[model samples]
Target chain A: MFAGAAAALLVALVLALARAVLGPTVFDRVQAANTVGTLAMLLLAVIGFLTGRPDFLDLALVYGLLNVLGTFAVLKFFRYGDLGDPGEDEEHHT
Target chain B: MNTVVDILSWGFLLAGGAFCAIGALGLVRMPDFYTRMHAAGVTDTLGAGLMLFGMMLQAGLSLVTVKLIMIGLLIFFTSPSATHALARAARARGLQPLLATGKGPSKRS
Candidate 1:
């Protein structure tokens, strides 16, 4: 039964992937990416339970954090169109 | 005893799965970026919350349950913030929304 549920989620993931490939606009792709992240978190939880390890839950949590931070970073870059700010960025590096 | 919990979980997971599918379809079918964000929000909050709630039912007050709750909370909070920032960025760039007085999303991508 649980396997069946997880299988359904996999189908959803496929649909999201389709969006990522053909979304036309960058924001559409970003939306797809976010959805993918959420699904991945759920999948990790399910896998953790199924295998009885439960350790994978920790990984899922980390993945979730990365997912949000990654999205925000991408959006910031998209908005600014530059990953660095010249001397100010160089100062941080030094 | 177990039957009630089983039904609850099944209902939740199934409903959440359906919402996720619909959200993805909207991601493809919507006309533009902003509409896509609206659709995406549905999946992030409602779909994810339902699935996590179902999992919690099965989890029964454990560390896993706490983690699941955290996941749901994170999505709920961050998804809206992401959407707001995206929309604000778009608007600031002078991408006028094609709404009939804010009725629906822009009709063109």
Candidate 2:
């Protein structure tokens, strides 16, 4: 059962990768990348259960946290052109 | 009792996998970035929730189950915030969502 779930997640991961590759815009790639992170995290947890190693769940939790942070960081950079910006009104240029 | 638990766990795992796959398909087939985000939302919430619930059942009342719940909570809190930020940033940068009427690029000249 765990193997089945992992297989499905792998399929999803591949599809998301396709979207990331075929992006018409940078945001599309970012969105796809985020989805990929999510699928990978789920995959990690499922694999942990399948292997009877619950420690992988901890890894999945860490991965989930990092994925969100990474997405936010990338989006901030895309929006402000810098990682640390307290200024409220930076120029809005795509 | 053990058989019952096994059956329930299998059901949850399979359903979660199916939802995840469908959402990924939508992500690939959606017309634009905003639409793709919506598809991704389905996977983030439903797919991950069901999978973790299934695993929790398998783990029973233990620390593993607790960790699974923690992971689920993290996903629930962070996913929407990240999606919102991505959409907001895109909009702020003049990235107009695609309209259904087939109108040409909806950006200011």
Candidate 3:
């Protein structure tokens, strides 16, 4: 049953991959990348169970954090065309 | 027993898969960036949440299950933030929202 679901989501991931390839805009591609990140985390968890090694949850956690940070970084770069906004960020946040 | 749990997990998993597919179709079908942002928010929030919930049931309510719930919460929080940021950036870039006929922003350029 779990394998069936994992397969279904894998199909979804593949479809998203097609969209990413055909995306006409940068934002569409960015959204595709985000979907890929979320799906990767879910896939990791399922694979962990399939292998009977629950310790893989730890890897999922690390990957989830990385996915969030990586998405933020990519969006930031696309938005500002820079890794950091030295003036506006420091002033606005602090 | 595992049968009941399996039923529940499969249902949730199937629902999650449907939501993800719908979101992808939305990506292909939606008119522009802002509308796509609307679709993206729906996809990540519900789709990821359901898939994580299904996995948690299979995990049988343990520490890992708690972690799974936490991850869902994180996605719930961050997905919107990410979508909002994308929309704001799109607007900043002068990307226009798709509105129904005669429903666009009234203030003319």
Q: Candidate 2: DockQ?
A: 0.78
Q: CA shift at A13, candidate 3, in angstroms?
A: 1.0
Best by lDDT: 2
After superposition, candidate 2 runs with Cα above 4 Å error: A87-94, B101-109
How far residue A6's Cα lies from its native spot in candidate 1, in Å, is 1.7
Q: Which stretches of candidate 1 lie over 4 Å from their true place?
A: A84-94, B101-109
* Residue pairs with backbone atoms closer than 3 Å in model 1 (clashes): none
Candidate 1: tens digits of C-alpha lDDT, residues B4-107 = 99899989877887787777677777766777777877778777888888888988889989988887777778778877877876776566664545667535
The TM-score of predicted model 1 comes to 0.85
- For candidate 3, the share of real interface contacts preserved is 0.41
lDDT score at residue A84, model 3, on the 0-100 scale: 75
* Chain A only TM-scores, each candidate in turn: 0.85, 0.90, 0.87
- Sorting all predicted structures by TM-score, with the top scorer first, yields 2, 3, 1
Q: What is the DockQ of each candidate?
A: 0.53, 0.78, 0.56
lDDT of 1 at A92: 59
The DockQ for candidate 1, computed on C-alphas, is 0.53
* Each candidate's interface RMSD: 1.5, 0.6, 1.7
What's the CA RMSD for each of the models?
4.6, 5.3, 4.0
